[model samples]
Target chain A: MADGNEPRVFRIRVRGSDVVASCAETEKALIALEQAVAFPRPLPVNVGCRKGGCGACRVKVLSGDYTTIKMSRAHVTEQEEAEGYALACRIMPLSDMEIEPAFLSPRERMEMRQAQKFAD
Target chain B: MSQEGLLRPGIAQLRVLDMDEAVKHYVEYLGLEFVSKEDDGRVYLRAYDEFHRHSVVLREADQAGLDFFAFKADGQEAVDGFRKRIEDFGYTVDDVPAGEMPGTGARIGFTVASGHRIELYADMDLSEDAPETNSPMIWKTMPRGMRAQRMDHCLLYGPNIEEVEKFFTEVLDFHVPERVDMPDGAFAIWMTVSNKAHDIAFVKHDEPGKLHHLAFFLQDWNDIGHAADIMTHYDISRDLGPTRHGITRGQTIYFFDPSGNRNEVFSGGYTAYKDHPTRVWDHNSVGRGIFYYERQLNDAFLSVVT
Candidate 1:
């Protein structure tokens, strides 16, 4: 729902899928995604803390304008961010965007799996 | 006994996200004296007590992790001996020319079994404000932040625990003062070449080249509590602290820098001697070994690394 002055519509490209979803612009990409769609099963986004302390939820914006909150360099390097990688939980969309979530490295995937189990 | 081999944890190079924020955290808040920032964009700093030109080097970069941790060898001959031994052990050593870092001598570096860069050097120019030798006051200047005495030790996380343990002992002459044994294999080891309980340590993790924390030495328990107070006052992000490690028995507080590299300020551990038996911990009681007061491991301590 567009409230004229309150919100704007943006299109997002889900990584590894052809589906494009229309999402309401929000403070964070994750929140915007949650508002517009839901995943049938977990796609291993590996998010935690959501405040940028942990290096989870990392993604790469393929195209479009966006801004991000403060983030830990441990997760995304400035060079990598400049090259378009970002943390989805910290990124705020400013225009129509296309992003591809980075696949976790073998070690990172295992660590996330273990951490999720422990958290449960 | 002569101190003729590895002498101390002499230098640490860290990558920071923002130079301004890193300076504020390390200088004004942590109290290290800013020595100089090179034209190449690296910042050099030292504790008030250190005689070296600098002990910590900060580079502004997108990544936040250790660049390398170096030890001060007793002499040029000793450095050469270690370099030869390291090469003989199968890892190629690269020479870092003198003046690559200001006020420092040539260094030899090689990757260790656990995927961390370890370096050794034998010379450094004494700082302009080094502790006075004659009629010296308790300190040349008043301490700030937690009044850190020295950059003490670092805990690293990576794979191949057995090989790393063997490399430190067989190649570097570091003796283990404490260790944790997991069911699968050796989970962790605290090693030292000097008298301090642990000069460096490592934990078993899948990731290579991950930093657990960089610790600095504080005076005593009072200083540890004061550090906690300072953390509260400045609103620094804290992980855990003002607790004791059942292994080294050091009083400690673990916090984070703006870039998310964990930092610890601790005091009071039993003096380590080569003759002392290595203290061992079983996986079941390992939580107590890491945090004596809590007696339970926190999730962050186990998983968080930069």
Candidate 2:
């Protein structure tokens, strides 16, 4: 919900889900999502330090114009950002948006499976 | 036996949570000299006493862990030899061309049995600001922070300790100075290629490729105290220590970087010669072996990894 002074409805498309949440344009995309339920369940983005240092909350801005603050070079390389990846915690929503949170890589998936087995 | 082969631990690239906080911890607090920041946002740092262009590279990332650890071979031939040996040990080796990393030459990299990326390279440009070689003053400049002498070694946690032991000792010519064994098998091993007690250590864990801590060499016990004072002043989240490790006999302190990666500053391990007998510890006495003074492991020591 946007206040009268800032009543721009931003449609945030998370992952590949058709469900879109109507959110007010905000400085941080993550904060905007937190205010509105965009998915059936909580978004799976992992976050650590929220100050654009950890790349845990990184997502691909599939089809939206957004601005971002300076982020760490280690997580999102220049090439990655150029390819449309943005840290949700650092991005300012400017228009209706579509984002896909970075999914686990193949290596990570294997590790997760192994870890699950160990835990069991 | 070739006297000239693997010379020393050379490079370590760590994924940090915040660049600013990481810089402050590594530079202002740990006494490393800032070298340069690449366009990719990675910052290079070197200790004041080091001659290499840089030793540590910090990449701001979401998670905290080690990216890779590398050693300097005597020359290109030694690196080539290790590559062949490592490949023969049944691991794929990747050739990284020169200039892939600033100031470094070609390197051969492989993932060891412990699920850690290890690289061997033979060439790096000397730092222009390295301590003066000719008529050098002991005080090249005043050392700062805890006055860390060098990036010493790291302890990594992963599965398959027995395989890792064979890989380092049989393939890489590293020698075990100490090891812990349980009824199941070897629990942990401390290995070295040089005179230092251990160049790298590993603990048996269910998960692969976890960093325990990267240690920096401090001058002595007093320096460890100074480090503790600085940590307290800055309110750094301390994990353990200002205590002695019965394993290496190092006066040490363990603390966390803002991103939750553990960093250790330690001093005073006895010199390890290749001929020294391997010290052994059993599961029952492993706690005392790890922490000599406490004689018991801290709750966090065994569970924490980044």
Taken over the whole model, the C-alpha lDDT of each candidate is 0.83, 0.82
Deviation in Å, model 1, residue B72 alpha carbon: 0.2
Top lDDT prediction, candidate number: 1
Docking class of 2: incorrect
Instruction: Give the DockQ-based CAPRI class for model 1.
Output: incorrect
The C-alpha TM-scores of every prediction are 0.80, 0.74
Where does candidate 2 chain B have its weakest 10-residue lDDT segment? Answer: B297-306
Model 1, first chain, TM-score of 0.70
Pick by DockQ: which candidate is best?
1
